[model samples]
Structures are given as C-alpha cells and as structure tokens.
Target: MSTDLDYLQTVLPAPSARLAGKVVLVSGGGSSGPGWSIGKACCVTLARHGASVCVLDANLDAARDALCAVKALGAQGIALQADVADAAAMERAVQAVMSAYGRIDILQANAGIGKVGGPEDIALADWERIQKVNVDSLLIASRLILPIMSKQGHGSIITVSSVAGMRYLGYPHLAYNVTKAAIIHFARMIAQQYAEQGIRANTVVPGLIDTPRVRNTVAKMFSADDFEQAKAARDRQVPMGRMGTPWEVANAVAFLASDEAAYITGTELVVDGGLIGKYV
Candidate 1:
C-alpha cells in the first residue's frame, strides 16, 4: 500500500500498441526497494505498449508488485520467483511463461549485483558472486531462450549495462565493471551468431540513474550519513546535471523490444544523460 502509486498512476508513459502481439520476459523484473527500478519500469512500459509481460524475480513479493503495475495497465502477464543465475530455476520460470503465453518474443536480462572494490582488495567470493549473477545468468537465460526464438524465426535479447562498463565512474567496483563490459560483448556475440536466425541482441547502458538501488547502495558508498549529499554529487557527475529516472531507461528497453528497432542489433543504446561522453 505504501508503493509509489502516484508515479504509477500519473507519471507512466501513455499506452500504445508499439509492441502488440509480443511476449517479453524480464529477468529481475522487480524493484530493489521502493519506487520503480529499471526492471519494474521495463515491465510496465512494455506492457503499456501491448506486450504480454513475464515478471521474473528472485523475490516473489517484488515480482507480484511489478505484475500489479502490468495488470493495472490492462496488460496480460505472470509473475514468478527465481534466482536468475540458477539454470534450473530459470528453466522453470521459462516453462511457466510458456504455459501461459505459448511463446517469448523478447528476453531482457536485467539481473545484476555489485560489490565495491578493486582486484587488490575485493574478496574472491564477492567477485565470483557478481559474475555469476550479472554475466552467467545472462548466458544461461540466452542459452535456454535462443532456440525458442530461433524456432519462432525472430526475437529480441536486451541487456542492461552501465557507464561503469565503459569507463570508471570514480568507483572501484572491479567485479561489477568487468561483468557489465562482458555483457555488452556477450550481446554483440549473440547478435552476430544469431542474426541469421532472426534473434536480435543489444545492450542498454545507463549512467547515474536515480533509483532505489542507487540511493541504498551507491549513495552509501559516497556519503555514509547524508544521502542527499550523495545524490547531489552523482547528479553533478552527469553532463545533464541530474541523474536520470527509471522510466527513461524503460523507454529505451521498450524501443529495443519493439519492431521500431527491427533493423537494430549488436549495439549498445546509451541512456546515460551524456555522462559517458563528457570530459573532465
């Protein structure tokens, strides 16, 4: 009941049929805390555009919460809980989606985690954990879904990366940076390998997006006491002088998932507010 009903009610994009007759499976399709995470926004945005959505998250409550947004938009969708890094669990989630929708026209890998540290100091376990969740999960999901897409003779695979992947953001999260970089290449490879089969793959790179995850995790790294200060610091880092909203990223994902991007593949759509191109 304490959810961001205001944003959900008034701030969402106007509905359209840009993605009519498609099914989009979003991994980690839930909010990390309050408000809209990129994954949750993607679910809502895609649904608003007429794609039947499958909200898959490790947290059932979070998944259902996102599903509510999809359903509220008068869109069809199902929510399921699973660790995206777990092959068996993801397989089951795909099975459940298949049972309900019969086919998947798009796969969006949005599951990711980070531990702030450089190689000289980062724990080995932490390194492996980030890779497993961020990289391996994408691999597993794409591996399982590729054949289904191939059979359909068309599909879109979208990935979420960060400006961190392309360059340092004044942070030292080595594992996170590596995994994100790997994701871009992973999508590119899949794009080339599966182009003939009609499966298009691309990555979305966002910079300084203001979301719950940033307020909770990244903010703490900057200011242990005042999150507002942390937020301000991050905002100034963007050339646009402000952090982006989750809906902005969602719009990019929805575009990639739609036929409007039919001729696009093996590319990274940056939603970074000009942060990556800026020079200090």
Candidate 2:
C-alpha cells in the first residue's frame, strides 16, 4: 500500500523555477526553535527556484547554516548578520545587498520573536523587545529597501505574520499578537502607496505550523505525553488534520515574491491548513 506522503506528493505539483535569476533578501533566515524554521525554508525554496539569496539573521551561525544549505542545493547564497531592529545596521545590510546583487528583486521580512505575557503581567521591557523585533524591524528594513525598489520600478516585499493576530490561540502573547496584526496593516499600506511605483507588499500569515519554535513552546506548555496528545488534538482541529510545514509556508511566500503573483498585492495569504477558516 502507498503511504500518505506518497499520495500527497503525487497529487501536489512539482516545484517550479518561478524566481529564476532574481535576487532575494531573507531576513531572519535562520533556525529559531527546531525542525526547519519558516525563514530557513524560504531561503531554501527561493534558492531552489533559481534565486541568489542573502540569508540575514541575528544569529551568525544560523545565518551561515542557511546559506550553506542553499549552496548545497547548487544555488548561490551569502550569509549576513544584522539586528533587524537597528536602523543603521539594516541600512548597511541593504546597501551591501545592492553592492553584491546590483538590485534586490525580493525582500522577505521574516524576523520576529514570540514572548508570552498577559496585559496585567506583561513586563515593560519584554513588551518593548517584542514590539521592536516584530514591528520596528520590518519598518526599518522596508524603509531602506523602498528607495532601491522604487528606482528599479519593480520589487516584492513579503512579511511573515500569524493567525494569532486575527484571533486568540489560547495563549497570552499580547505583544506578539498586536505586532503581527500591525504587520498585516503595514503591508497593506505599503502596497497601496507603492503600487504606482511597481513595488508590491504582502503578508503571509501562517497558522499553527510544526516548526521548532512551536514544538518547543508546546513542550513547555504541557507535560511530555500531554504535549504530544495536545499537539495531536490541535492538529485534528484543522480541516486537514495536520499542522503545516515550513516549506508549505515558504512555497506561498515564493509565489508572492515571484512575478507569477505580479498582479497580487496588499493581500494576506493565510497558510494554516484551514485552521483560520474553521476557527476564525
């Protein structure tokens, strides 16, 4: 008997070279929690599609690992280290990309941090940190890329968000939720203002993905057996009866960044295995 994986692969279309010869900058393109993180998956998928990628991460090692993986796939990649929240640092990073690639065709602002806290118990410093990482970083990076993209008359900016921004997820991460919601609006506003300039911005809001971060967080939230049980239960809540992989999310991002999605802008593509549709 054929396995489910085999059946799925048979039904799903093969990957395409949609972004051939393009230059893409992927921020936070590193491993965060466990398994393949979304940023890492994006870097790999983009490279597989024939793009020369710049892997930017706060963790130098993680950035290097992502670049190495891309290179292993016979694609070109460079690892960059930068704190996305630092305006000057981000500007320099963009300048470096311009120097190396002549021009950037895609910008994936996927860096973010998740912290748990309620409105009454949330610490000021934690709140500030989450906001700075999640929202401020996107602002600074986009600000630096806007002029370059405007001059080129064509570019794509894809931001990673979460369904938590739209509805509750039985968690107390107020700051994370707020920043993610802001990102959706941010992308929409940028799309509206820059469509005339040929720059498109969109948000990829992933649902409960089976990334390392989610797994580790789940482990922390429940006992070992309970964690597994709860995870299975949560997965069953989705219409597909499973959590999505980072590669699935990356595939959506690649499409939005590629010319294939040229006419699509300021839209939120939720890749949640029907979780948002059922719950929200």
Candidate 3:
C-alpha cells in the first residue's frame, strides 16, 4: 500500500540528461513536513534531470531524507547542514560543496519564512528575523558563490521569491512582503552584474502554494480553527480557482537551472496560477 509520504516522494521523470555532469547546490533543500515542499521538489526535479544535487538545510536529517530521493533518481547526492540565516554557516556550506564537488554549476536559494502582520501589528524583532530569513540568506548565498562562479565563468542562480513580494495577495504580513520584494531586485541586480561572467540569475515568484508550511501559516493568519476554510479562502483569491503545487514551481526552477535558459537572465518567472494577472 502507498502512503501519502510515498506519493509525495515519487521521483519525477527525467526529461533527458539536460543537467548531466552538472552540480546543483540547493539551500533549504528539505521538506518542512510530511509532504512535498518547494525545496525538496526543486532538488528532486533537478536530480531527475541528471544533476548531482547537494541538499543543505538546518535540519540535517531532513536534508538526508531529500538526499535519498536525489539518489533514487540515479543521481549523485550530498547532504550538508547549514543555518542560512548565519553568514559564517553559509560560507562554510559553500566551502563544503566545493570540497565535495570540484565546482557548483547551479545555485538554488529556496529557504524562507512567513509571518503574518502589518506594520502596526509587526514588531522590530519579527521584521528583522523575516528579513534575515527571506532576504539576507539570499544575499549570503549569492555573495559566497559569485566569485566561485566568476572564476569558473559559468553558473546559474535560481532564487525562490514570493508573489507576495510583487504585490499584496490577501495577507497582512508586511515583513514577508517587504523581504520577498527585496529578493527579486537583489537577484536581478546580481544577474546584471554577473552577465559578463557567463553567470545567470533569476527569481521564481510563487503565489498561494499548497504546501504544509503555507497551510499552517494561513491557518494562523486567519485564526481559522478549520484549515480547510483558510485553504479555500486562499484558493478563491487565485484567478485559477486553486493554489499551486510544488511540482509546478519545480518546473520553473529546473528550466532556469538547465542550459535552456542560457540566454535568460535578470527576469522574473511568475508561478502564481494567474493570481498576479488578476491583480493587474
């Protein structure tokens, strides 16, 4: 018999060896709960397509779990523990990957936090924490990897920014909104600065994703005892009448990480299920 976990861990089919011989380092590369997560999906999807994936997360065990999926795809895998919010830890993580795999070809920055509150309701500490998790972490990863990529003269950086960053989408979390917005511009600037170095940087903006982390956060934000109610409310907000799946976002990450996007850089890929279209 198959369990939900079994279903969630199913390997995505390879689309050929597009990423063969490439090394991919994914930060926050694990699931937050017993279901598909954006980070895990990205790692697995990239691995399925032939990339050797390095799974880095604060939770070493979870990182290992995702590493298993990477290997299941007949891909090489490595697991590393790192607190992305800590600059020193991230630097060490970059070094560790370089030690294990001579060079990194793809950098996936996917770790983030979501807190619900507006300016008046948010506290200084909460705002700072959110910024560190959502914004500073991306900065740390990019700073550490830029020089390495420059020396190699080839690399792709795919960051997971939220659609909330582009505009408000029925959430009151000012900190999450502001920090996510920062991730977009930060990635774009990196793309522009590193274009001559044969490096590419882009942001994947996800909206109303149906992941465990998102479910719990929405429940808390609306004070809804019934998670279903909160979920349906989120569904209604999207023009497509439903929230997106992790696999959908993974597709975007894989495209950017692959050579298919060699000429694509400094652009925003909106995986919002038409939510942003409705907003516009």
Task: Tell me the whole-model lDDT of each prediction, alpha carbons only.
Answer: 0.90, 0.87, 0.86
Model 3 RMSD, rounded to 1 decimal: 2.3
Q: What's the best-to-worst order under lDDT?
A: 1, 2, 3
After TM-score superposition, what is the CA distance of residue 74 in candidate 1 from its true location, in Å? Answer: 0.9
Residues 106-192, candidate 2: write the lDDT tens digits: 999999897888899999999999999999998898888889899999999999999998988876889999999999999999999
TM-score of each: 0.96, 0.92, 0.93
Q: In candidate 3, what residue range of length 10 has the lowest lDDT sum? A: 1-10
Model 2 error, position 193 (Å): 0.5
**What TM-score would candidate 1 get against the native?**
0.96
Question: Judged by lDDT relative to the true structure, which candidate is superior, 1 or 2?
Answer: 1
* Candidate 2 local Cα displacement, residue 53, angstroms: 0.5
Best by TM-score, which number? 1
- Give the clashing residue pairs of candidate 1, or none: none
Which candidate wins on lDDT?
A: 1
Candidate 3 wrong stretches, greater than 4 Å: 1-11, 219-225
What global local distance difference test value does model 1 have? Answer: 0.90
> Per-residue alpha-carbon lDDT of model 1 for 182-204, expressed as tens digits?
99999999999999999999999
Clash count of each predicted structure: 0, 1, 0
lDDT of 3 by residue, 1-280 (tens): 1123455455455456999999999989988876668998888889878899999999998898888877766689899999899999998888989999889999999998867789898989989988898888887888899989999999999888888898877659799888889899998999999999999999999988888688666666676566778788779888899999988999899999989999999999999889988776
